[model samples]
Target: MVQGHYESLNRKNDERMNAIPYCDTGEVFEADTIANVWKREDKEWLKRTQSDRSGYEYPRLGESPYINMTDDFRMEKKVICQDIFWSCDGTSFVSVHNDFGIRQYLVPEESNTDKLNRNLLLPFTRFFRNQSIVSCAIDPFYTLYNENSDRLAGDRIVVGGKNFPLQLYSLMDGQCILSYDTMNKINGEYETVYSVKIDVESRVYTGSCRNKVAIYDKSRRDAVWMNQSTKKASKGRQSIISCFEEQPMGGQALSRGSLLCGSYANEMFQVDCRHQRLERLNYTRTVAGGIVQILTSDNGRYVYVVRRNSDAISIYDRRNLQHELNVLRLPFRIHHNSAKLKAYIDTAYGLSMGTPQGTILNWGRDLVEFGGVPSHNSVDDPLITSIPPESEWRTNLSSTIPATVVKNCPGDPELFALSHGGTISLCRFGG
Candidate 1:
């Protein structure tokens, strides 16, 4: 009976593997040339075919002026933004800065390009903290309204940073709403939580120093579960975790929800929440540099990994974690610090990433509708490459891209990107 069950499992696995088509890596070109050519071609194609198609116009790629200095700052040094996130309603956004300042700005409904270009994006609310915020997350359920126009759970954000535990802050009044003790004592010191993520279930996951992951609910201050394994790696002890993301549940019948994490060693792993143990994925092996970010699809079907000092972003199938789905290579180098990526897979299927060269690179995935379904490539061509940014822009404010946070506004065909140097770029899909 056991042998029969094993055979059936193997058959199912084979069928699943055969269903996915291999992505083809066609002829490659220089980054700048690719972007220029794609823009030209896209314009030509739209001009020819858009007249026939009604209702869905492609987004216009445009930019707002550099939102750096305010009228009060003429001689002071610029404050570097560490991270930024858009609210669920897309009406406002919050930015975390290296100077321990958090600022919130409301998006104006009208496009006042001339007025905005002449001035900075002034914040409506500002909060100050003693420690620099490393990462933050908004409440998933915190939206502006309900079906009857009633206010829901809104105006709350959780932040984790240097020497402090995860604290929930109110966006309305800029007050400390709650705090979660995600830190733990290791040896003689307390570990600082570096990454924080909130899920639909109201649970927060925090990744801290010494490769630790802790789970906490808003109702309690103590961590519900903490995982700290001391397994020796090929190069001594493991490094701290850099990021955390919720992953999809696999096909296993006994599987529980999983939390994906990346470490400073460029290694990826999943924590089975129910089992409370670490599970290795196919890409668990270490790479050259640390992981910059791990972006997963909304439905959790795909994961895109960005690594430090690497020119390529790897795409993976959530179901088949053993093999990569495709590789999107960029022309510019991703520096060891201050790089970010935002990927979308639905109707607007594409990705945008920031480079150390002060440029934001974007690529439109060749899907069935956008660019007819791709044909399978030969085994010799393993890479299913993405064309260079449909839109590429370099900032004039700073030499290095300190922090690149890209947020896609819901219900709109636009993108908002922020740099640590206090510049903001607005890109519309077509226009």
Candidate 2:
């Protein structure tokens, strides 16, 4: 019976592997180009034959019809753009800078010029009082409603920075609507909030710092709860909460009031915020070096832990969190200090990450393999020793600057990337 089950599973895996398309190397024509090429070819066919009953003539061997299609375009900014986030509707995207400025730009749906030369008009720009924005998140609820409106409404952006309060800005006019202080005493000293994420439905914002995670309720105008990591825990003694080692730099909201966070100590924690007492679940150390960012699949079936200065990403099955399903390694090293990973689950491109060398690496995978954890371990190798296969795409933006963030537009066919030297590039993949 066990042998029969193994055979069935192998067949299923084979079928799934065949279903996933291979990642593009950016050498062929994209979907848009193909469509345009077909249209042009049809017109040429009618002009040549001048009759509907004649067979169409194909292009010459050396000539390809899609040679004139534009697959990528770039835009530049004067000030360094630190981070970027796409609106839920994907019509526009917002970018933050180290100069405490937030600028929003409309995605160029149609551009005749190959290099978008003109500086795009900004809908609005919000400048905070001397506080540099490190990370930003948009309220998903408002993003959907702003898709069709003439004047964008109901959208809010949560911005976090060093020694600054978490502020929510109106997407319509770039006005500060609300602010909450996320500073907390850790071992008798206050620490700054490095990252922030907003739960639109709950109206709660979560901020993470060196050693603690703060949960701020927007309706209360103050922090409702806080969770601190302890050095050691004993049954009879009081555990001392401190931020001596762990530094949580990234987090995401999960179902049922749960939040998944990844820390610099190479630990991933799931905190249950349903009750007053914060319940911790699935606290496990990952093997992808020091984790700087964490992301979940759209379906929440798997969790991706991105490491600092490492090429591999640790993939964990949510159901069985004992071991990682697989550690995906890229061709290049990521930015050690500041880097973000963006996953494209439903698109032709699978995953994308930025590098310190201003390069964007795109990877394709069989997502079905992420469905569940394997029963048997594939290899028992050390974190630094394991190196997976190279990704399908590794395009460099500019060698002079570092890429801070890369994001795939949710409802569009473009991928956006930001550089430390104040440049944003939009890329379209070939089909």
Candidate 3:
């Protein structure tokens, strides 16, 4: 499987490199013209990418789809970054490190040169905590338009780690504005928060060790609801809450959305948030190795499940969770760390995820000719096929260190790759 995937990837890479003529453009990538190539270059791209209704080919993997070691953002002291999140407004991004540090990088809207220099771009604000941080999230209400229209736009974040009580910090002044002390305790010790997520209504959801999940409302002093797997750890069993995700609103009129929690067990739990007292609605079918991360498509049409240490990701029908649509196989095995997967289904059917080997792999469906017969499927149909899928590999991060997370700028063509060795690599799509 690995050899076949590599052969397909190499063939596609060669085709892409040979299709476009090498040229040098001296234009800087400003905020206004993001995710676009030069006018002449775009015409050539359209000529090469023109397909039938099925737009499965990837746009571009950058100038070259390999690691460039000369441009990495390194700090004076080595501190591994556990996770990173881009703000609602594409102006900045935040990173949580193992050294109990939270750093924010302010992306300048305007740059002087065509190429961006990682050295000049540094973290403008710094926040520190006593314990290590495992997961972090930005306030969903923090937006430039919202802040200007309403004075109370959220500028705070909820962060939790290998400690007690999830805390919310003020991004403006670097202060602990609020803390949720409603976390459940087991065996006289609080469970470590493995993952965190906040919904549109600002309700915080956290997954912890021992297959535990807690939901907190800002108005209440305690958790509104909490749950744990029926299978106990006392029987020499070890199953942790690997990840949690919230369903999208999808034009619904509800104040809160349903939540999905994944554990090391075969089944996953779903909680309906419509009732005052949330309860487990149902459990999905048995998944091998359990699910490490759950990703919802932008349109809420499908759900992507990433399994622990599995190279392939399973896709399911959003409305009918029990139905399996297709599987995405990767070129390499995902280590035990369980890298996060980012979905870009808005403009294209593509997914990006990092590997412990420091390579960022992307899977984009390809438009096949179907033996000279043109074929297409409606937008409502699930993206699946019997044949093995194709993938593109780009190792922008360190080859030695494991890659923790790969995030795309909110409205730009740039990508930020975070490595386990406290280094970040910035790669632009057209650069």
Candidate 4:
């Protein structure tokens, strides 16, 4: 199954090369104007600029111009990035650093010369002292223009921090729009919010912490429902709900109060936020490992659960939670400290995972045929396929840089993977 997979040789070739050929244009042009026409060297240029403006040059054809290079974006930081999220349009992405600073980068519309020059293009960055952003969610309903007045109202980003208030910021300027105190004394004092999800249409947000989950309604400017427990037994069994995801049904414009969450108690459950009390649709306890993350299919039919520090993932059918459809195991151990488990299931790529070993593994849907059968020898099971030497879809990053997040770019064949060391790689499959 791994045959025909290709690994990008751009990085390897970049290290052994020194200089690229270029046509030195004697005239100078503005940086923006030069960047606009840098790709077309064959076109006639009518210079209307002074020599001191900025000397410009264009790469000749067949010279392996840097503009044709595939290595899109890369950045280095003093600390490992905590999390990275792509915008709804896939044109930009935001990454959070351990030092409570947030950096947003624009996905270059055109390829660039080098990583340093690419980053020096002035990305949007903001820092918050004494506040470490734990989770962030982009408002799905936000648009550039107001519906009523046709005026511009910028998009908003919701962010949660450790022991800090849940704050909303303008996506354009990083200015605070609103803030809510999420710390609750009833569930467990000093409990920090670890997860947050926003229902943009409803203008409501859900936050999960140590032993409680709170739903804040933007219209009311207060929590509509806050679940907190005071019982001793509840506290003992209570586990932090580290992950929360809204599973919007098919044909629904917005999520209809249905949410899926994973807890440290080794359980995966669904919650309905319409009611005042905690109402569950389905709950199941899986393997001994804690539930690290929960992901749903585009149709909301299948649920994939990632286990912390475990090599296996449990897949369940949403209609029937009595038993898991299948339990698929990986070849290597996953990083326990990794906050997010990147998984995507689509027709083109059945199911792909970015592992801690810096490899993207594709476990196609063919394994589902082995369901309901117990294998006598786990190692020799036909369902378990190892990474082969050559596959058209597999990519092996450096062993030192573990891929913390992997996401597919919309309307394109590209897959973006962010490493633990703050490096982002763009890979094209089946091209």
- RMSD list, candidates in order: 14.1, 14.1, 12.9, 11.7
Index of the highest-lDDT prediction: 1
lDDT of 1 by residue, 324-354 (tens): 6766667766655433443333224345555
> Which residue window of length 10 is worst by lDDT in model 3?
17-26
lDDT of 4 by residue, 71-125 (tens): 4221111344566555545566665655454555556453445432332122333
Candidate lDDT (C-alpha), each: 0.54, 0.48, 0.53, 0.49
Judged by lDDT against the true structure, how good is candidate 2?
0.48
Poorest 10 consecutive residues by lDDT, candidate 1: 20-29
Q: Where does candidate 1 stray beyond 4 Å?
A: 1-77, 112-120, 144-152, 183-188, 236-238, 246-256, 283-287, 338-349, 365-403, 425-431
Number of colliding residue pairs in each model: 9, 0, 0, 6
lDDT of 3 by residue, 1-431 (tens): 44455467657753442111011111211112212222333344455457425776633412211123223332123445566666665566676655566656566444345342332333445556656567667666554334455334566678876746678887655678777774444455556777777776767877776566778775455787776666653332246766775332112323435777676553456755554432342344432556667766554566777765566766766666766666666656555554443333212424556655765555542222121011344456444443233444454334676656666655553444344455544454433
Error of 3 at 134 (Å): 3.0
Indicate whether candidate 2 or candidate 4 has the larger lDDT: 4
Model 3 misplaced regions, further than 4 Å: 1-78, 109-119, 143-152, 183-191, 229-239, 246-256, 275-288, 337-349, 365-398, 413-420
Off by over 4 Å in 2: 1-79, 115-126, 142-153, 181-191, 231-257, 276-289, 338-348, 356-358, 368-391, 394-396, 415-420
The clash number for model 2 is: 0
Q: Which pairs of residues have clashing backbones in candidate 4?
A: 2-390, 2-391, 4-391, 4-392, 5-391, 5-392
